[model samples]
Target: MNPRDTEEMTATMKRELLCVLLLCGAVFTLPGQEIHRRFRRGARSSRVTCRDEKTQMIYRQHESWLRPMLRSNRVEYCWCNSGRSQCHSVPVKNARATCYKDLGVTYRGTWSTAESGAECINWNSSLLARKSYNGRRPDASKLGLGNHNYCRNPDKDSKPWCYVFKAGKYVPEFCSTPVCSQEKNGDCYFGKGLAYRGTHSLTVSGTSCLQWNSMVLIGKINTAWKTNAQTLGLGKHNYCRNPDGDAKPWCHVLKDRKLTWEYCDIPQCSTCGLRQYKRPQFRIKGGLFSDITSHPWQAAIFVQNRRSPGERFLCGGILISSCWVLSAAHCFLERYPPHHLKVVLGRTYRVEPGVEEQKFEVEKYIVHKEFDEDTYNNDIALLQLKSDSPQCVQETGSVRTVCLPEADLQLPDWTECGAFWLRQARGVYNAPSLSFLTASPFYSERLKEAHVRLYPSNRCTSQYLLNKTVTSNMLCAGDTRSGGNQANLHDACQVNMSVSPYSEPTPG
Candidate 1:
């Protein structure tokens, strides 16, 4: 077919954009246009049987306007539940916080494995095929739970826990999320951290910290964070702390879960520069969309709403460590309380449950003290995940931390790096009736990476960068190919729905 045919087809398909108030428990997509039409017809019959006059009226009012356009071969479709009870209209808000810390309540990130290495049982699973349940289960959406078996803390437990099928019973098991008694800020270590008493018990590689006092230790749990135990800062817990005067904080954590103790991967506080600085990569230049296998350090962040039900996707982050995520300062401009954020790692798909996904509650929030929202300088923020035991997140094949680029490290110009991007909108503005379809959040449902390159510093000067001021801290990088040479990068700048760590080119 010629380009004219494609143009005509696209124009005809988007002739009318209509918003049908389709209500449903979860977003469900159709296999193809043929299936969508078939299912849409079946949904029409629900107008009366479904007993939802209001929704039927709203759909029917636009049906006449949408009939001709819906018949187009190029259109896609997805049917929603006819019941009003199942429908949840998410209030659209400008995303700010890089993460959210809830009461272990509406957790949506996919972290399904239990602390005991047991896989969580799905909420909608038929394992309890019998009529009565041992305990009442809350609505899956209440905790941002899909039908999948991802772990969540519904009862406001000390940490996120899920039920595992044991023998004939569903036994509850806690995930790696920090418990209230043992949770603490895992980010900073000041002046040897002698007085820091929070329990953060894991090594950088997810190893449990060894107790200074071997006698009173029960498991990796510290009995007292006291100096009287005569070891180092052996206290009630084996959390990471600096009892001995060292350059940075260190602890004797069990290496590889063995009896032998080895100390490594302990976070060193950045005494000089800030750890929140984020390198901007607008779009992947040559590569379009890659997956977690390629960019294991990529992280997705979300914020919980107090007045609303489901969590909202806020921004993308780079996992610098197991317990810390780095994003842009603008992502947290609204000044969301530290507890309103949670980070998800190892999730290949935005909403789909990943088998090895891990979720963490934010324990500390740090934005650049000198951030300039106007100039976009210092556009960085750091989120500290609450420590549960020792490590906040377990490293997985799809969820490993990225190494910090060395200051003295040398690389050639145009050095390519991984990037996260949102799909740009096509100029297919149909009639105002279908505005919802044009702005639907369902597009780009999976995690993707784009290839972007590091240009020579001399070439990225103010004269070459659209006359924007080249701040000392700012880095200029984006796709420069013919079709992708648009100056702006990162979808958060355009879309009001989903946000990502980004800043305007430092204004001249």
Candidate 2:
């Protein structure tokens, strides 16, 4: 053997050993580096693969018991021995089972019960056993009972199962009252998920989850129900029962600013309907004398005639308020002084005065600010009477004020209305015009009345009035009589003259 060969082989062997050591070190270091990188990416590996044999056995038993009762894909389990414990989950396996026990089979504390012969507790039958033992109620505090420790059954179609702690142990009962299921999850659950079965509607006035068997056709999600329920003093959420008995439950909801039941029919509010007023008996026909106190608002206006020395009959007015009279603004065209005019009320005849007649001096007069003489628009005026008392006139059977119509009030076309005037020949409203007579031959000095029908605004426009400007504020009316012995034609002009104290006949 040569010494050089032996030395070379020895060096080779040492180098090979050093290379092997380096490879082993690299293998351990690389794995640690890779694990650190995986950790940075939120990946983790389990250090322990095998669980305690006793724990595995308990978990398998619990899984078998709990798989059937789960309403959803997940099921939660908890340790009965731990006082302050959390729920844990397991994969569901048996889809056919209907009953589930939430707490695993164990005693309620960490103390061993092997010598005492205390068997593992079964949540379903444990309550019944406790109730029967000693014939006394089970104290919840001593048993460490909580809402999480419950047994649920999901198979029964309707009125399934609800277990309530009563008479010391949980007994079959209805989940009528809300109970906390999980304090950390803020989930207060009703039992059997059928609290509102067969009911049309449910009101959750308090914050809690109400489980039911039927599907919700209409649900106010989040805060929508709170915002709209019983709004405007209306009743609670309205619902209709499923007539077919197969469809989901539905209810009324407010959509597009309107309330609709089941997204279809509209629901009527309690305040819907038209207001009505009492109808009077007296009527306006062709030319006739009005009953003595029939039109109590009538007033006769008088003015001092410029050509004559004393005051003479001018026009008529309607008393609207105690101190206010409504008339046509055109009546004041002559601009008579307020002191020179007088108003007489409760008078049926122009010359012959009534026993209940009252008189007043004009204090102030106001023509409409927007009066248009060319179109006769806004021809209304108000007159204030001079009086020592706040109320200018006392109301009586022959001196009542007329009610003003509301601003939005509408009347049908062709509605009949009355016109009133004064005639000297006839002492009352009855005064017929001579047939074939022209130029108002029926004129009289005493109060007279006639009827006319209202004309539509379109007919009163320039197209019908020989191009006369008619405005939206103006009203039109015409006589509707025909045939032999027809009544004289009544007009708005005649009505205006009868209701205005300052009106004078226009010169032809």
Candidate 3:
């Protein structure tokens, strides 16, 4: 697939400073009410709980696995040659059949023999999973070794495989299972190869790949990211993957016995998703006053003021690709001509240009066809940057594209919400999380981020929203605690988001 087509990562939600800010600081508006503080700290008495759609799907998938496996043949094997070795049998609950290639990821059958007709070594064997390969014990949960000697594929192998005793040592061999077919590459991957599940463990120079869940490689990639290894689909087996938004599938390989990262030389059914830059060495840091370098994907959008010499801050956008900026549809409802708008990338200050900043004129914009100005439903817009070159902006220290969210992410109920700020004059307010109800003028010149939390679906219903229609796409967030920062929020966005006396007819 074209990298441009794949780079529409953040375009999924189409948020900007004003839109994404959502209710980070809780200046929400209901149709009949002037303004409503969407959040109030210590007010969980009336709060409703919610489980996102992804959670429901996974729960359903697990329920489906129970029925068919009970009818399959159960097997038993002795796990180790050690004095403590004991014969164990497959547990009924974990037994699974692979009907499709994608099912290979979730396959948990009790087939314990390898292609060489060798008995598969039990994962619990001291010489294998229990021993430290290189400073890290082989991860059992990551490898999906559920006690039995069942053949499994934790790595993206051609089919289900396991270690077997051969030639005085344990070696890996494929198993003939109905779950994952021997044909390796049949609908095995997802977009841009982030979900690449091929058996391409060799680098361009034919170096063998290290296990993705290897403690050494996990610590090398980013120690902080180790916890997220499973979430990124990195597991026990070493297979080339694009877990961190790289241009192509890659893995940590041993070169001259030193661990290093390299791109896999294996070719796929489709073209690799190319990008303008490589993954950064480290993750961005967070604080009250967000530096532009921490938010490389941010775009400072502005409108050419027809009545004045200078432009006015329109809205904050996020870079999805080298040439595309995703923002709210309401920001363009005025129908401003493309020539009248500009997008500044890699900017530090909101107004004063940063040394690494790159500016581009707006080429054109495409808003959701069903956008509702009144309800802000389908409130997404994509702006194309006018540029002479194909890559409108180069990926730099202060400029990069954000990865599109594909997996469940498994965020908590109180997910962090931030507002990307844009102000006219250079001013700094060392504050936390920002929000807005309307366009405000008194924001600080420095890019500001506000810490915000998500609200349950019940709290953001039409009855609570002044009878305005609320859609699934529209998220409600806010700061529940009312404290010293209220003054800063009042002055920062300069928005009159305070609740009106009449708006609050009920005591609750």
TM-score winner: 3
Model 3 residue 11 lDDT score: 62
Most lDDT-accurate candidate: 3
**What's the C-alpha lDDT at position 205 in model 3?**
74
Instruction: Write down the lDDT of every candidate, Cα atoms only.
Output: 0.51, 0.45, 0.55
RMSD to native, candidate 2? 25.6
In the range 11-70, model 3's lDDT, one tens digit per residue, is 654655557566654554453243223345554323333222322222211011111234
Compared with the true structure, the alpha-carbon lDDT of candidate 2 equals 0.45
Q: Compose the digit string of candidate 1's lDDT tens values, residues 15-92.
A: 532222232212344345556665666455434222233334333211111111233433211112443222333322
Q: Tell me the deviation in Å of residue 271 in model 3.
A: 18
The per-prediction CA RMSD against the true structure, in angstroms, equals: 33.9, 25.6, 33.6
- Which of the two candidates, 2 or 3, achieves a greater TM-score against the reference? 3
Ranking by lDDT: 3, 1, 2
Q: Per-prediction TM-score, please?
A: 0.38, 0.37, 0.38
